[model samples]
Target: MSGTFQDRIPVLLVEIMRKFPEERSESEVLLVHNMLSSVSMFRRYSGTLQLLLARVVRYQRLERRRVVIKKGHWGHSFYFVFSGLLAVTKDNDGSSAFVDKEPILIKKGMSFGDVALIKTLRRNATVVCMEETELMVVDKEDFFANKMDVELKREFDYRFSFFRSLQLVSSWSYSLIEQMADHSKAEQFRYGHVVVKDTNDMGNIIFIGKGQCDVLRVVDLTSCSAYQRLLKQYADSVSRGTCLPTHGFKSELTNQPGSVIKHKVLLNNPPRPPRGLLADLPTSACFLIDTLHQSSTFGLNQYLMPSKQRDCRRFTLVSQSMEIMRVEKTRFDKLVDNTTMKKLEALQKTYPSDDELCTVFLEHSRWKDYKHSVVQDLFPHRVAPIRSPKTQKQQGHCGPSQVLQQTRHVVNRLKQTKQRVEPKDNKIKK
Candidate 1:
């Protein structure tokens, strides 16, 4: 793939090279090398990306500290830093820091405003030039300019993502990974702040792309008695990999590789309860994130907050950020064996595949249905999930007696809850 992309890359590079202003040629080559050298993550799409790079126009060269991409402005092209680091920054919220002329630095991977371009929404954060930077800008015209082969281009896009995830962890297959990309969020919280109490919605998977957090129990903030007791009960039992109670909200520690953990699902939030009252003990908001570098700690929580009007804005932005990353999701996709594929299909779990899921169906007949296992697997060490009766037969090779036992566990819990509530009803009548 590298040899072919390199062979064909020069041809495409010729056009852009000839047209580029002589001053930025060295910078352009640097960007080309960077794109070419991404062998592991982007081996398959190297050819297409090489072409993508060639068609780009090397526009104006801005000074080191120039404001390149402004927040909320409509941007259409992709830009690369040929040399030097370009800081992704936004204004501090009308605070003293802003008056003092200090713009906040966003983390390196958190590219500014690309999601707006892809989602066709407004830029959410301003991207400023931190140092003297050389940039290559490619617009929609450049994107659509080369009409070499659309079919090949599309296939490359999907495979590129597959390869990216495959490279991350070779354990996953495309079948396990298909339709695997789901809406996600990057959130931040102060060290002591609670992200979510120990509760399990049994929906959505959590990944700590950056930073870390501690897993705590649901305790009453107002009452010391209950809080101490709850904390004491599972004081040491809830290690990172340990699963939360089947009935409680699910979460895990992040220090270890495969631990059950939960994060606030910012991409989608359940409509707030309308009773105009808080739940028991403030739900003991769990301070799920335990670590943060000065670089990543700030801005994440604020970014995930729902005020963005365009709710999908964050997902699109992060997706584009992931796009510039240019990794193929191949690793996770290939991990999809009968077990993983069945689980993904049974749960109807959708990850950030874009159009990649379509091909997954063609690969396996069982891919037609969603899998609950895929969702559970996604959450690191999240334990065996509670499956619905309808999804039971699809659970695959299960012992009937065990299935019946698990079925009773799920059903009897509901019955016991009803029985618990009956006494409360009688007491009210008396």
Candidate 2:
């Protein structure tokens, strides 16, 4: 068995070399044609396949336990694993520390580092050879010029068409969109899976690529009976030294945001109301106020902000078995020029202010004693179905959420109006 195994290695290498064209030297082919045929992405461009195999691809061998790629460095080539095993590891947070996760095993006949063929982005993970390995590699310049650019163009026209339709990104140039498409990664989530939780600091900007998700906010509940119990205790109570009912129970419920002022005022002067208090006081309420669907985006504000500054998530994003595309903030920042940034700033102004959101939350909490609809109008009904322009033509009508369905259209009109007024103003000044 040992002798056969040793003989197999030389035979395989010889076979790979013999497959080259008669005119070209044996060293020139560098890879087996059958291996290239296995990659689905490369199959469509058959006319240029042989040329790509000859000019770009090369064969390389890695020794056991050798690091082939390191995290945080720019990737300039795509690697196809022909034989042996590899281990993949990445940092937990965008930090330099990589001890957070165990290495994932990748076996033979698979490929990795495909993103390197397009954009010059930092490697999110490190790849190391687990044993003596054979690989077929394609470097960036030829890969993009000959093959990947064509695939990326079709991808932008289909699966990622949402990037072009986006009102906020409409002002972005074609080159900028191409750069973003290169750096963005497609990811999937199962039902009931939490994509992003409150207080999480993942710096990637997420755009729903294909499905739906629920935006949730976890809130603590204080039952109506608990509130009334507190009120009754306060009415009957007094200082420990005084002859008032000092033995009544003290409610230890957690405080809500911005409650310090309310507490101070209540201590200074108490309002005595008649006995029959409202029975329907909130036991609990929705803290998260929005339901984002396909094409919806988040983390852009944080992405635009400086990296050194601390930022926290306000809501939790739980997927309903969806697919999403996310782009690293650092990659976007590197690719986007000053002109693109200015257009993005103009687009940002069109969004409803963050101050407006805070006001809505406060109003909703205050109206908890009234009908639910009184505050419900402040937010959209649910996740709105987002279809691309091509799909919209095939589909008959929009889904249930009227507000969300119209929100993007309204924002686009606002942008057009703003531009019109600005040009007129410049003419008037002249």
Candidate 3:
């Protein structure tokens, strides 16, 4: 088995060398390999298949405003972006008028032209370089020869199917949906990953292609009426010497007579609620505003409303092992008509305000604390005893210092007992 494995190594090396074109250096081959792995469409293929693709791809650099492919033309080759941006448009002549339409952009790590080649049909859209672009081109003959058409076809079908099922775009024309499918890329995120942060200004219109996610808003509990009531109750309990242990409080109060006034001032001016992303806050502060399932959409409100009218509350979308399709807000605005835009604006749901969510959270938290306290009072024996400072010190199994302290304590107690017994024996003898 070892000898057979050793014999296969040279054959594999020779095959790799033959796959790469003679013009490509070892460094260039490695660069192409990295590019293929980074691109979503090509990343799913096996290492051998990727290597075969890297072999046939040729480098092409085009200046800004150059037309890579025009609509109604025969599909000649497949193109993958290595750097810079390209715009996909519906214009047949590739005129300047298309620029006003804000066409969908294809950027680095993105690929296009597969739809036309895989279907063996004329190009349905025009792709023009928006910036000086570096592209890796695979001619139609080499693309088909390597059977890459099959994989490209599968990806195109998957995207199309997903877009077709979406109700938001159900009224859209078939061609428009196909164009969207060509531009949008699908991405997967693990559970608890923040797909969109609260502070993001230029957010993408996201469609939950698969799995679930939560829309959460961070609320300031300190501002709510319920929180104020709870705070007042806590203060009252402290004043009555009920909730807190009295041993430390008595000494502190004796040492600092004005501490009560300072405490009240501190309560009145609680530190300003933390500002920034919801992901940075504690989970308790983040309230679930909505749960998004497959086919649900978010980040549309920004496009539907003017800047001033848009909701100012900060929120984030966290994934639960989800697959999402993201379209740039600018691209989506250009894709749909005014009527569809109006319909989407009407469908936007209003979420609970921070003040309201804060009130609810405070009430729920209070009830939970009440129930726990009642349980401890009813079943006192079942509640675990809290260790005292002295007991905690002895429990530290860290080093010899703790053991020496414990020994000294025991010895001091024994000396005190012996001294008391000696005094009592003297009185009895007298």
Q: Model 2 TM-score? A: 0.39
Q: Encode model 1's per-residue lDDT on 1-430: one tens digit a residue.
A: 1122332334444444557433346556566546444422223234545444444544345555567766667767655443434554455222222234645543222323433544466666656665545455656454555442353345545544543443223446444333343112223333333343322321223333334433222111223444334434444445544532321112111111111112233212322212522222122221111222212211223222345431121121111011112212343333345554443333221121211211221111122112334655578677676899878654433232222222232222223333432223221100
Tell me, by TM-score, which candidate is best. Answer: 3
lDDT, candidate 1, equals 0.35
C-alpha RMSD values across all candidates: 20.8, 16.6, 19.9
**How well does candidate 2 score on lDDT at residue 257?**
24
Mind giving the per-residue lDDT tens digits that candidate 3 earns over 1-430? Answer: 1113332223333344345465566665676676566665665444555776787887676877889999999888888776677887788655553456666778776787866776678988888877677677778887778777676566667889999988778888989888887767677777766677663554468888899876655445566665556556656876797652232322222222112112221122324423422221112244445668888777764555567866777666667678888776777777897667767865554554555554544433444456656876899889577999997664432222222222232222323343432233221100
The all-Cα superposition gives candidate 3 an RMSD in Å to the true structure of 19.9
Q: How much RMSD separates candidate 1 from the native structure?
A: 20.8
Scored by CA lDDT, what does every candidate get?
Answer: 0.35, 0.50, 0.60
In model 2, which regions exceed 4 Å deviation? Answer: 1-65, 69-112, 116-160, 171-173, 188-192, 210-212, 220-286, 302-314, 320-322, 343-430
Clashing pairs for predicted structure model 2, backbone only = none
Model 2, 169-189: lDDT tens per residue? 676788777667665645677
Choose 1 or 3, whichever is better by lDDT. Answer: 3
Q: Comparing 2 and 3 by TM-score, which wins?
A: 3
User: In lDDT terms, how accurate is model 2?
Assistant: 0.50
